[model samples]
Target: MLEGHALGVHGEGVSIAPVDFSLARGGRLTLLGETGSGKSLIAQAIMGTLPSGLAASGELTIEGQAYAAAEGATRRALWGRRLALLPQEPWHALDPTMASGAQVAESHRYLRGLGRRRAREAARRDLVGLGLGLADAEGSLPGELSGGMAQRVAFAAASAGGAPLVIADEPTKGLDAPRRDAVVRLLAATPQRGGALLTITHDIEVARRLGGEVILLRRGRVVERGPAERLLSAPRSDYAKRLLEAEPSRWPAPPPPPATCGEPVVEARGLAKWRGGRALFRDLALSLRPGEIVGVVGPSGCGKSTLGDLLLGLTGTDAGEVKRAAGHRLAFQKLYQDPPAAFSPHWSLARLLDDLVRRHRLDRTAIAPLMTRLGLDRELLARRPGEISGGELQRFAILRVLLMEPRFLFADEPTSRLDPITQRDTLALLVELARERHCAVMLVSHDPALIERLCDRRLVLGQGEAVLAPESLDAQAV
Candidate 1:
């Protein structure tokens, strides 16, 4: 069994107060809360990554062993062989310069003392088991793989770690529905393999689908504990009730018919594109009118992200004419699907944001309100990129772009790393900005529910082409 009692984790004043909880062996528990309600901190403490200044008191244990009492070497041995953690962003967790297979093999070699050949062989087997195409992806670098693919690589590494306990923090944050389901099933298999899981998530539906026991966390304390179905269906506390109620689909949808006001801010005609041999865009034509938000959705590798890059002129088109309105200030931004590595780990958030502001000659006054809206205070801005949550960094990236006051914006999975409430807040802010500034926003996402909520118009991508939703490609001639 795993347990935490009077677990006060603090630096200066207590950041996380006394909290108590328990998880039976082979049981599953989910910790849910807003962006910075101490959820990540608790996970960090469990993984022994908490800082020196911050001390953890009370008791924490795994199986029959007290985790807090374990010696350094004992703890190190326990980490990968007996316990493992899947951090929020797989790409960030992955070694960008190493081959995926090499990285996965290294995990096995280190944890199990397997030789190079044996580890490589085992790595290939695990990758295939994780629903990845081993041949196509084995030699690829982290940057070469899609977000979903990178996440699967991370999963394969964790599985190879041979841990009996797995702590998955936002494991499905950026994954589409299909990938999410695959991960849920993978977690379900852990118990059958004689393992236990602690899934930290903000999405209730995820908790519902992966039904097991749950411990609902708020402000570093457990507020409710019971069967997942019971608690999500009929919560006793107001916090739990609100969390259960805050489904993405529950939010109001964007107004229909898509406000097609003003001139076109982004234009592309007969845009054809390819990477290696895979065609991403084929004879695609689309236009984004000022003051409108357009959503592009498709399965992974269907070119949704490619279209965004094409729109931003980051990728060249094979055969097409693409144009941005004259003197169009982009204030254009893209919160990378995996944002942690988007900046240097050594650089402070303030340094990055300040560089962006000064380089673009943007007004400095805009920083405070944007940071406030994104739930970041002054203190957080001073920390290094590794110090803050992905949600915060994602928001900071967006704010950095907003300060540029671009005439258009290209956001790819902008809210993928955020908690439910912050997801709503960020999307709402984008929608508000589009309407207020008449900025054309091109949002690339795989979430249908979010598309329905934030998009003014929707496009569905297929094999190298995009078809306007509710308006067939056959009717485009009209």
Candidate 2:
């Protein structure tokens, strides 16, 4: 249903080497690579959405329609009908001004030519099928939904028309195990609809779940391709081998546990948060002790990120109190999930870091050593956040937070956007720094393996409260 022959992307002075591949109707293909390997570029090339000044070469055919020379409406029509993309960043993919339901209904209304009422009904059903309630899905705006909900809404938009070819770019980027499984099932079942599935991702588990074939890319070149199981198990190239080995599942055992947990550095008591008359969580209580790493896990929209915000005093609790031990306010820091949003678009990395250092009266000499330890180049400080890869930006984000020398840290899915290798490295660095400083760390993530490896205790949030689960007791906290 989709084919690319010697397809390449080039701009003013750079180019992505040409690559060749094809997917038959109902077939599945996964493009696997680390950050900066041109995975997204290849997807953009096929979708005919390459940025201005960057041109695509060779040929791209979808549903037997050649797009090399297609123009205007011809290309646009292919998007919602013959081809649809589930973008990497779900929040950005949506139209903030439009109601979520209306945006999703557009696929049915335009591509399938359904009546307004019918399209609305179909969209509601699609949303419900993806685990969202009819009321929440229909009434919420993009801004009103959680990251995971926005992702599901995007999926509904892409698949509503039953497009012949669906291209998903990291569809399960920020979801828990349950939601991830749901997405995997959704894509796996796409073939039964007489369509093809093409996904560009850095997740080995995602690729393995949507099994069929895998194409490995490295530095813009195709290094390997074969059946998913065979390719992953017996990769032919050295890069592919390293990629497989870098999976978090293969990481060595975590470092030895902290010798002794220190006094509570930050504490929350009887916390309650409500949004739009709905309770996110209530009467939540937790404490962060120095030298301890706490993991927060739950299904999406269960208040994990919100809890992080509350702990950091970034958001006010509707009821109850958050208490930081004396002199610990400035010693508290947070690592946001969306690094781009956390930064000002107008500020260069240098300016942002400098401002932080200046405001905190921190020594400038501490900057270079932290950057080196995080595997970040000192040169990156000169570029804006937009100019760097997500992994790099995440590293810098961590660096910026760490520079304050916080005694307690709140990290919300810090490695969600990163590839496995980068994820491992970033986690290792964060843990190391936290240990050296004897800082208390609260890590919010959906990856169970990560929680098990890094956390001394886990907090499971659901149904309006967080239940603390200590590793030693294997018992739930009241």
Candidate 3:
């Protein structure tokens, strides 16, 4: 259903090597690579949504319709009805002010030509099919949902128009193993219905599950492409081998139990929180000791993030008290799930860094070395938050927090957008620095393997029965 010859992305001083492929109906093609390696760029090129300053080159044929790949406009009208692009870290893709159901309904009403009543009903059914049938879910705004919840909502909205050919960019990010599998099933259904699918992902497991063609890329170049079964199981290229090795499941166990922890940096007792008329958590008790790495896990909207916010004092709790060790006011920091949300889109990263330094009286000398450690380019600092790739911006957010020498940090899916090798390396650097500075860390990730690999202990949330609730909270502190 989709065919491309020498498909590539081109821009000032950068370009993705030309690639050729044909995705027949009922076939799946996954683009796997490190962050900024141009996985998403290919999807964008096909969707005719390449960001400013970048252009697509080559020839593309979709559903027997041929067009110049560079003519982005030629495919514009097909965006919703024939082609759809599911964005990465989709919270930003959703409408913050609109109710979830309404957003989905909009696509059906306009793109699919459904009436208001029919569109609304269709949207409701879509949400329900995705397990978002809870009475309150359809009414909630993007801000009211968890990272995973927001991602599903975006998916519902994007696919509402019944687009046959789909481009999913990191569709399973910020979701637990079960949710990830569920989404993969959903993506698979498109091809089963005789539509073609092109997926962009960093997850080796996701590619294995998709079970079709796989293209491995690095630094805007294709290292290899072949059947998923062969490429992933017995990759020939060195980079491919390294990429597969970087999966959290293959990581070596962390060094013996975290160095004898120091005094508690923060403590929460009998903590409880309720959102949108549902109890998210109750009787949750945990403490963070200096230099201790704690991991958080659970299903989407299970209050993992709410718990972090409670500990960070970002929100008020109905029943709990949190005490923090006396230290610099800025010592407590959080690396947000949506890194772009944490920065000013209007200002350059350098300006934001400068502002933080001036506001906190932090030392500027540490910036260069920290940037190097985080694998960031000095030139990137001149771009605004909206200008860089999601993974790049996420790393920059980490750099900002590290500059303050935080005593306690809540990293909320900080590496969700990053590729395997980068994810492993970034986490390693974060662990090393946190240990050296004796900073407490509360890390949250959907991958159980990743948690088990780096955390001193794990806290699982959402194994309760209260209607999208955590009242009967199952607190397993492993």
Root-mean-square deviation per candidate: 3.0, 3.0, 3.2
Candidate 3 lDDT trough over 10 residues, lowest sum: 464-473
Q: List model 2 lDDT by residue over 115-204, tens digit each.
A: 999999999888988888766667788777767888899888888877778888888977888888899899877776788999988889
TM-score of each: 0.92, 0.89, 0.95
**Model 1 CA deviation exceeding 4 Å by range:** 12-14, 69-74, 113-115, 328-331, 470-478
Predicted structure 3: lDDT: 0.86
Give the whole-model CA lDDT for all candidates, comma-separated: 0.76, 0.81, 0.86
Q: What are the clashing pairs of model 2?
A: none
Evaluated at residue 349, the lDDT of candidate 3 is: 93
Candidate 1 achieves a global lDDT of: 0.76
Q: Indicate which candidate wins on TM-score.
A: 3
* Model 3 lDDT at residue 340: 73
Which candidate do you rate higher for lDDT, 1 or 3?
3
